[model samples]
Target chain A: MEEDPVELVVPEPIPEPTPSAPPEEVEKEEQPAQPTPPAEPTTAAPPQHPFLDRKDFYIPPASRLPEGSELALAKAFLMTQSEKSNLNLYDHLTEVIVRILETRPGNVVDAFETLSADIKRSHFVVDRPNAPGAFQKASEVAPANEIGAAQVKLFEKSGLEEPGDPEAFGEIPDIMDLSNLWEWAGVSLGKEETFMLFLSLKSLVTSKPLQSVRLWGKILGAKANYLIIEGELKEGAVDEDAPQVEEEVQENAEEKKEAEEDEDVPKRKEKPVIPLPREERVGVNKYVYYVCNYAGGPWTRLPDVIPEKLQASRRIRKFFTGDLNHKIVSYPPFNDTEAQYLRCQIARISAATVVSPSGYYTFDQEDENEDEENPQPQNIIINPEFESLSPEQLIDPANWVHHVPYILPQGRVTWENPLGQKGEEEANEDEDEEEGSDAGEGEEERENVEPETGPGILSPLSSDEGP
Target chain B: MSFINLDDLPYLTLVGFTLNTEEKAAIQSSLQVKKEQEKLEEIWLWGKILGVQRDYFIAQATKDNLFSRKFYYSIDLVNWLQLPDVPSSDMDRISQVHGRFTGDPAFEYSLGEEPEEGAEEKTINEEKRLSGTVALINYETEIVPRGAYYRDTLHQLQKNVNFSGIPKGELSQLTHYLHFREGFDINKRTLQERADAFDESIDIFETIANDEPKGVWSCQTERTGSVAILRSLLWPGYVFFHTANPPKWGSMYYGTGQRNLNIGFML
Candidate 1:
């Protein structure tokens, strides 16, 4: 028996995506488990300056290139590189991004070609907020701008923008350090066909505390033209109870009660959105997550807003969708509405997970008593997924990977920082002092410094700090 | 060469526990029992009190007098307990001591129902395990929370609570802090005697139990979201406490302009 040369995932197309096709749930009772820029030409605060960005750094093209590039799709490359771990360089990063954007086309297609044309031309001449935006503003319909007029319009129409501020990025455990946020990007692999991507500055730069890192992440996502920003926020140190989303939703919904957010995001044709079943497969908490090939159908445009609507992509999507409005989603078993879209997206996430070596299986079992024999429904179908965002896979304690995206020649780049970070920068000065002490640096030190000593602390602040 | 210490503790399902220095001291102290000279007999007792019966500690005192001591805190128990495969009694005694060390005076304990006063912390800890077969100590002494306690003991208990450790008010200040512990001699009680409380629980020397605070234990509230960050620069070891401030990273899930939300107690 020979393997099929053309198939990315071998065997029959695991049809587990179709939930109604007879629920063949393969439940993995497995345990569970920044960017930005802007210059304001030096206004806001010291931390807000573009001078904080490093000038020498440049993101290298990914070592592994996606297929189909150079043929159907143009070669994807990072537009600019300025963010660095040094906090002093943030201000410079904004200017660098804007400077890179001024010359390069905003359009995703021409973006690769336009960089050299305006390499010397400076179109991004310092614009303050509302100071007649320089590039095309990604409005309901993208308005044309300086960098590759049609290209800017194209990328803007896709609705992708730099990642947003602290208010936007959430769920980062307080024990995590956002400064080295990009180190976690090693797991995500992007698609050349789909315009979807998971964009972040975590892999490209470093910073302290999770908040500022998150803020920069939002901007980079928006600028890099990411379809979905699936990163998490800082874990609660106080508010140790569930923070109420409905309160904010109700208040926000007043403006768009029941808005139609369910226009385009895709749904798992067969499975329903539900929580992941309990399975203790691995005890090692994972920081590596995957964004799959499912491009939730086109943005689910909505008529009004509800609190839950903002949570996910739904048949009746209500929250201000970063990707939906941008038209980044193109495939789906769509929910009748965006409201269904959110639930549908969640369903798709629960219905299956990315099986390593490229298998996609339903994350939760629809059938309580699944039969292993007989034409048992294939719980996981190894599909040739391109670029998909499954938060359900991410939130799993066992599977969640606090990932940061690297922007370069290829699309999504994932790299893990071997140092491992939680919060606050230790300056890593220990390297200078202890370089010679590593001779016997084996079981003894690890035994002395096992990360689990604190027993799975939910936040770095919860560690036994001195009284 | 692989650097995992596989020989130390067998990895069962999850790692069990290894007692640190403080934990060892607690076990030693709680396991200490005093001999009661009823009238004039100077009978010596050994083995920490396993429990309290009325006014007497249902203790595991040595039947013979050889182990008796005027007060031998031990240079050997530390070395002895550290030996591979320490006895189960030592482990039990240590756990009992840990319970006492971290006990909060404001915490009210009710093993089934409240005991009739003068209960000892060690006895209280043993009864927490629902097996009747658990209390090996039968009584040579009793430690009761009386209606008349001095200011000393109350100060110690108050110092070890979740809130007190949080750098705030005294837990002993609460009137409801007095609980029926291990001692109060029930047989000595005449009819119409409640015998289980102190008029001023604020007075020190009263023993308190340690358990999850009433409302925040498991099975309470919706499955609240939590993000555990491991910051080595800060404190190490297990630190479980509640904070009003939620983590900022959670907001990344919502994407752009969404407010970051947090929950209570990040353990």
Candidate 2:
């Protein structure tokens, strides 16, 4: 998929000033307009500062380049201007965003491009937080500040700031490290798209522990920030036995009570055992979790805060596993969701297993219980052309190169540490010295120091470590 | 190895047991009777105990006696009743020895049920079956909780469990520990007794029995294709004591996790 370039705001078309009188009058007006600005500057100009002459007041024609180099110059000048003022960088960016959104909604792609561009611009100067904020969302929205004073104040009060920008390095960052607390560029999507994105992330983390991730995106048509998170992949933490959702728990308890009250007619879907996705496929002790902080819909509150600003809020409403949120994520038959689940399983198995050229089907076609007359699933798939290949050709390593991504080779991580080796060598030297002393005198000396009598005839216990 | 070596006689005395002259003769005669009547085979006197009215003697024999075979006898010194295979009695003796070693005083000759104290007549059917028929020692064994030596045992069990020079008298401790650590429940009463009372066969031991805990366990099935024990230790603190037979892994059909949830003694 090709990504769209950051869009520049198309300025409103300027209206043409009507021509007053005729072309002669327009020339006279133009002459006065040019001469009067010079005459006024000449009358007010100080003779001591010749560099400030009327002619010098005019902007150079170099600024009028059509390629929009003027805009970059103007931006640089404004940045210098803001450095003198109390305006903060982030507040300035937020004000820019509010003004853009204030415009009539046009192309979605263009809007996203503009939004990301403004974000990247602000991200360059955004302040780093001194401490991690409390897990909660900011409820109040402050007035937008053209000079980012208010945003700065909010950050100062909350003791939190947006994630650091990677563009500061002048290069695109690598894919977010799954082992670290990674932050992705926020996006606004429909509820369905959000669910799909969640599924994709879950698939990625299934093979490796996604320690932490913060994805700040808006759910379309919702006024509140909708946050869905697969919680921390902590080891040995079994999810709570019962469903963590309060409503589900209540429904289950009520159904149980009613079942006790009545005997014969079983209520369908009452206390319906919500099956967790991939729970059966995964290990019983596997601890994969998730959380949906806010499930926003049409009836959700219209919070004054914007999504980007809301991301600054440290409020984590709940902690849960992927199994808990599986209730909301619909896994339909033969869909991308299912395919992703299968892919994750395959990736995990591939990581743990080694594929070999000597490997073949553990069971033969004849061993399968499927009817011979009926269409067999294995038969439906075409087998690789192995018959024409020689035995040596069959075991060729080139044929197995595609599996490289699945298994990480040991050599890649087995870098030798000189410091560690030195420590080991020193310890070994100490052990060798201890063994030498324990050998009693020396090998030649021990032969000469042998007991004078034959075996079993000893002088008994001696006052020494070795008796 | 023979059930008891001559060197172990002093250890038996330390445990408050001593064999008299007549009791020793009776045990020797009983072994002779078993050898003659049961088509002749090598035998070893494993344990000898003097009871109130009769002397209880245990003799182990094998066609070869080289490999670990589960064949033993419980004989009465008075009648010379040569009972071939001690059924629940074998498990009882093992349970007592393991209990003493592990400091579990609650261990007894039965499950939770108290054993009948008074003398009881041995059934003719029990005697006949013991003389030649297969003696199945099926009992629930307690799994040691994941504490102390759990990590150590788990690491060691991952390698081969070799009980090569381990004494037969002390085999109970090692066997019970291995079985328990591998998530099998152990007790004095046989699984058959529990099954009979419950009206269903609740033997999960068969599923995991094949996995010789390191290699300490003696496999009854000599040489068929062996199945690997499903490793349920997904995380350090997490524990899954129950496992399925035929090893459930990468299968389409789902089994209930509740059944796999352990309901047994910890430690």
Candidate 3:
């Protein structure tokens, strides 16, 4: 019974409520209960300490955060929030954040305010005259002028001119007119491609002040095709002592050596050699060529075509690989890569094929009898007295003639380079040595002199009429 | 011979075989004169074959039979001299001479004697070889869109006047193109392979899809999917173009006349 009382005392705080309890016993119980309450608090203190140590609002460290958490947060925020009536508040906030991040201004709050204000100022506003629920015409709600203004702003931001603006093209030839002209000749780049090319060409013209620009024909490559554009530079646009002149001298020397060596070979039968006509800088090299892989691709200007490269290109047939730097491995090794080859071929094709209606152009008759050593430069002018040929007369082959002189095997209009008098003297010495080796070839000597006296205009015609 | 439009030559310039205005005019007039002089049932400009010295312009003409078309070549566009017939026996000999044409009809290629002992040395001239090669190329790679021609009841192959054209969607597939040549043996095909209802009138030729050493023909859609261009890998520079709408088709061979021997390895 005594053990039971001790057990009751040990197990129960309820014993304090019993009246049978002594005053000293009650006091002892109170003391222990107070300490027990304190003990409970002591036991819970560690967990409470962790909670107390946590920040008021928590953010996971970058390492602990889930992948694409920002995107998830944004998606959740967008889903929960209703759009503002007149503005995309979410987009505005995002743009503000981006600007703040990019610029990282010292006073972020101030920067944010300024950026938001600037964006609001520039934002395209739609004039809403009708009440909230009122029916409105489509054109009234979105006027063409406002749309065009927005488009112009977008084009300006992209650093491109609006294609529809006539002034954007500046001096570039009108594509519609060019297409119509080419259609008469039975040539077309297709409707969509022509428009695309025109837009690209307009951008090209905007970059520089060109006197004239024309779409040259495409050259197909093994991998891709080249869309060529020919443009004439304004006078004084290029330097007089350009790198091309130095290249021409070196090329001529190599060509001269090759010609001399070719004469010595016994097995090969050579074609009748004609002296290249004098290099008319105003004639051939006047037009600058730019090529691009596609209609909208960036254009690259090709180097000036030296006569040596042109002559070498004539003897070989190769397919381009669309890479401008591709080396041509041929029997008579090409000196340069595909870019120069392309330029040379362009020069050759244009000279051989491009033509105009008879009497469309007239030669400067005043310079007709200029000194052979130093022929005065003459420009062919548009004939004011030109008369359109009837369809009947136009159908005849004899009625049409090539306007450009034939690019000879030596790759020039005249046999000797008038600019390089020293080179000409060396060529004479080599020719004398070649003649000495082929002793007493009087017939060959006469043939060599024939081209110097022959009329240049009639040469291309006679050659076309073959044996 | 097919009817070729001279206007289409300008489109061919996109592939690098451009004819100048003078050449175009000459060809137009010369073809008309030759058509009258030869009394050709149909005639067309074939293509240009590049040579070391000069280019040979080819013209094809058909008389009584479409299969037996005659070929004429000219160095100077004014004259169109017919190429002589090449015997089948000399074809193997001609194939041995694979060098580029010298532009001279009289140039002879001495194809060294056959491997067998006591065999005489063989030789073939440029003209005969040219004819043989043209025939070989025609046999192997010449193709027409399905239904362009139909075999008549009397077994005569005639151009189908009512043939609208192969559909634009079907143009890019090789199965829609057929080798326009004789000797398509239907009996050789398995019963399962011939399960489709084959119309004898139009399905008399072999489909180019079934050609051995597959991928021999490269088919592409151009001009905003309005025109289909097919190029032969075996003969590198042979190109054929066809348009579905308005129904126009033509082929041009502008090459060195050398077979692309690397085609096997490339494939």
- On TM-score, the candidate that comes out on top is 3
Model 3, A363-459: lDDT tens digits are: 7665564566435334567788889999997766666666766555556655553222333665456446655645335334434443332224322
Error of 2 at A342 (Å): 11
lDDT of 2 by residue, A1-467 (tens): 01211122122322211111233333233232233333444454423344432322443334222336684455344333244333433334434443444453667456766775664453323243332332222111111111134223333533453345432212211223321221111112323323333443433333234444334222111111223332234344343332233354346546864564466443222422221112221221122323232221111111111111112121211111112112112212211121123223323333233233322212234536444322222211123533344667655543331211211111111112211222355434533554565433333432343221111101111211211
**Which of candidates 1 and 2 is the stronger one according to TM-score?**
2
Worst 10 residues of 3 chain B by lDDT: B10-19
Score candidate 1 by DockQ: 0.01
Q: List ranges where model 1 is wrong by over 4 Å.
A: A1-199, A203-226, A237-245, A248-347, A356-467, B1-267
Full-model lDDT, candidate 2: 0.29
After the best TM-score superposition of candidate 3, give how far the Cα of residue B217 lies from its true spot, in angstroms: 7.1
TM-scores of all models? 0.16, 0.17, 0.46
Sliding window of 10 residues with minimal summed lDDT for model 2 chain A: A455-464
Model 2's interface RMSD = 36.0
- Counting clashing residue pairs in each candidate, in order, gives 195, 26, 7
Candidate 1 lDDT, B170-254, residue by residue in tens: 1112231322233334345444433444223333322322222221111100001111111100111111111112211100000
User: What is residue B238's positional error in candidate 3, in angstroms?
Assistant: 4.5
Tens-digit lDDT string for candidate 1 (A20-69): 12211211110000121233243343344333443332322331122364
Model 3, runs deviating above 4 Å: A1-186, A238-281, A365-370, A374-378, A417-467, B1-137, B143-229, B233-267
User: Local error of candidate 1 at A240, Å?
Assistant: 15
